[model samples]
Target chain A: MSAKGVLVRVSTYAALIVMALATLFPLLWVTSIAFMRAPERFAGTPPLWPDHPTLVNMVNIVHQQRIGYYFLNSLIVAAATTPLSVLVAGLAGYALAQAKFRAHRLVSWIVMFAVLVPNQALVLPLFEMFSAVHLINHYAALILPAAANAVSIVLIQAYARGIPADVLDAARIDGASEWRTFFSVVVPLMAPMLAAVAVLTFVVSWNDFMWPMIAMQKVDMQTLPVALASIDREHYQNIGLMAAGATVAILPMMFVFLASQRYYLRAVSAGSLTD
Target chain B: MARLELQRVSKLLANRQVVLQDIDCTVNDGELISVVGPSGCGKSTLLRCVAGLDKITSGDIRIGGQRVNDLPPQQRNVAMVFQNHALYPHMTVYQNLAFGLRVRRVARAIVDARVRRTAVRLGLEALLGRYPRELSGGQRQRTALGRAMLREPGVFLLDEPLSSLDIPLRAEMRRELSALHTALGTTMVYVTHDQSEALSLGQRVVVLADGQIQQIDTPDGIYKEPSNRFVAGFVGWPPMNFLDGDWLENSGLDAHCIDYGIRPERLLLQPSSSADAFIAGRLERIESFGGEWQVEISRNGSRVIARVAPNPELRRDNELRLWFRREDLYAFDRATGRRLQG
Candidate 1:
């Protein structure tokens, strides 16, 4: 290769590596702090590597701060929400994309309008609705509201559109009922988009704090993020403990994303490039 | 293995646009009928209606003396091979072949045996584990055919199944489709816009135009005795040539009509001096199709094409003499575009 071409290639790779490291630094620092002792975590000139690494901060948060209970609560809420969200969104999205209904346009317009409206703006009304129903301290309050996410529905619709309509028609003629066709053919074809939606729903539900805090007023009913916030308020000076809480809050989402990263990227790119 | 009949079938879109207007035809037991039409002429719509994929706006469809207008596709026992060969991309060839039986709640052993037999029949046994995307176009087409075959339905509806393939593959598939139909002896309704395929593959060709059945007859009958101007013009390849009826009168030929139709191959390049009727025109262009030639000739203001044996003596812009036997000419009433009975 020419010297100039070689220089350009090297510079491009260097820029990409720098950007990747920059994006990862905050998560790495928090994880490192989560493993450091109290003094090392709060030191003015803290080293990148913890001076004396320890799991005491993690253990203290799990035992003293009741993070384990809140972690379980978050897990329950996310587990309940993800599949429900994917199923509801996938069915709605397929209908929006393929079904020959008269009101499809109106329904699509409503979904587009919903997607444009920020979730934060709905928090007040949602909290009031849950409170009125006496579901304020329940997991249903967290699970139901986010079950049919507009963005996930739209993403799934975009992916489902790529599936040829004739394939579904063939299934129908092949002696499969509408529901059978959807489950056997449509759902399997929509697997990538479903995985992508599942990951997004789990992460959003896991990280959600404001609604969870408002809805789950009982101390024992709080999720991980709400519990972490409560710990921060009581132990503002304990940086190591706070980092431990943050690290724990992020672990499940990281693992979920890593496991389905292939499908997630495929779904996202397919959704964005088409429609 | 059943007689399929359509009685006064018509399909109208939601906006009240008529897509299939009062279609009527029948396919006898073990007979293959080709539904041929131009695009938007509702050939595919008719096929879909028969398959129960699209409900007919008004009509009765019967298979083996049983009315099935309201039955769902699955309950109707009709198998459809789509134009795009809609093989499920996520499934292996084996799974795709077995899917219909599996969905019908057939025993697993039977499903496997049927699928394996179909794979062997279609030469897809080696690719049974491969996904649809991993196969070539011909293999995918075979898989689709195999999927439809495994159902062993009473009637098969194929909508332009070979239209997507290249010329050679299409020819090969066309032969395979004909052989399969003969072996199975099932009532098949093949829909295509290509008249050549319709003429070659079907026992009877149903010609449709503008949502109406122009003619439904044996292939030779449709070719030789087109019921209207549309059928004559649409059925033949270099398309039957039409000349103004007045031209025949002006040339002193006895033609009592508004239009006269002549097939390209019927026009003789050189007429004997004693020939009763002949017209002379300037040759405009000559296209060679290996053994045959498409010769374009202009007389007065109109142009006509003649498919003639390639002539070494013919030159462009030269005056060419063409003759047609009186029996070979078709006279049509221009006012209604209907073929005029002698």
Candidate 2:
């Protein structure tokens, strides 16, 4: 209502809009290049929007480079990983948060330790185990290692602490078995955290590069990121083709985030579930 | 309906703390028994042991004449209504009421019938679809009671179920609990730290202090004849006033041999000089509520609190005389806290 307040509000929003544009500029540029004409991509200073847009790069990547196949491979890995990771992480987290079995503190310390151990550092031992088991090229190599995620477990365990022990005891007094109580009471109570863990697993599995690159060495079995890198070498000169492929690769992550964003938002405001 | 029994039921924490010690009690079939204690007195722990929610370090608990020490909560055939209601936050009232029957694998038609009937009985029919978070505290508590009602277990264990409610709602729930107990006539073990709740609602009351049972008696018996000094002080509101045995100049009781306690309400504010015992002290404080007043009288470094009718003429710091019948005085051993017979 005041002149100073109005100016401050206007300038704040203007600054936010500029920052948002800065963050989105690269994705926007790649999307524009994906539709640009071949000659437009080669222009000395490329235009923000292509004057002559075409789907030639998209067609080439799908038909010749088999980007669709690689996309499918990525989808399979992520789809398998999300629910598996959610289940394993949720159960372990709830136990760490509430259950009173022996060595609970020790196990919690171990999980915290695991969270500090970087995923990249485990590549050698993981590769060795997969090699010994003779399943290095299989989808199991991607899904299994990620299913028991320490960070997700920690997130879930912290959230699960909000669940009062009385509700669990009520379930027990009601003749519900431990498994029945978990599915009927605990799972719905932990919905937001589980949803959050699910989206994180999906996005990470979809965009993973180093492990997928080493594990899926076979050309036909490679996931989107590894396959995209392989194509990048041959199509380094063709910006249009590379952008088209990158655009396709970004779709599923966006889709997964959008699909589960409601519960993901709830997770940010968690721990008000119990009295 | 079932008879509940505790046979020297003792609980020891992992740190070697004695929580409950050699507690023995019994509740006849179809009776409502209340356990009352101060916080950390193991009243809730005793209920949990009966519910099989906590394991006793030693001793046996029985329901329906069957030893349930080793039984899981589900197999013990008991229902518990927790202090905070403990209704599943995510479940609607209907689902919460139906949970017990559903988990016991009762047929869907029966579960629905029982849940709806119980909801209607508790006047929760219209709010069946609302989750616990959407309901008021009273509504949540009723839903919890309904859930336990649906179980139709051999015994019901309630752990301070009305403690979270405000004063008026607590009175309402206390009455409702009594009505429910009368209607079902199932063995109910209600635990609360409120002496009035224990006295008003229970057919019998068990008073606990410092992880031990001080007394188990009818409400009137617990009030009229406390077994020890702890029960005498803990059970009554405004607590019993203690007078040093040595301080009373003409008393026949041996000095330092017995501790004397008298209920606040038992003290009279009359100026009578004929009674066997009486106290005179400067009026120190006055507190009034619900048409009754409690005043503190002090003299010669001694204080006596007495609950009496409102006296508009009384002024602070004025020397006041209070009297009690000699028979009203209670004596306990100074060291052991055990009752001393006249």
Best by DockQ: 2
Worst window of 10 by summed lDDT in candidate 1 chain B: B245-254
Task: Name the runs in model 1 displaced over 4 angstroms.
Answer: A1-8, A271-275, B245-250, B254-257, B272-275
TM-score of 1: 0.96
What docking tier does model 1 reach? medium
User: What docking grade applies to model 2?
Assistant: high
- For model 2, the stretches where C-alpha displacement exceeds 4 angstroms are A1-12, B245-247, B271-274, B289-291
TM-score of each: 0.96, 0.97
Candidate 2 global CA lDDT score: 0.91
Task: For residues B27-54, write the lDDT of model 2, one tens digit per residue.
Answer: 9999999999999999999999999999
DockQ scores for all predicted structures = 0.56, 0.81
| Winner by lDDT | 2
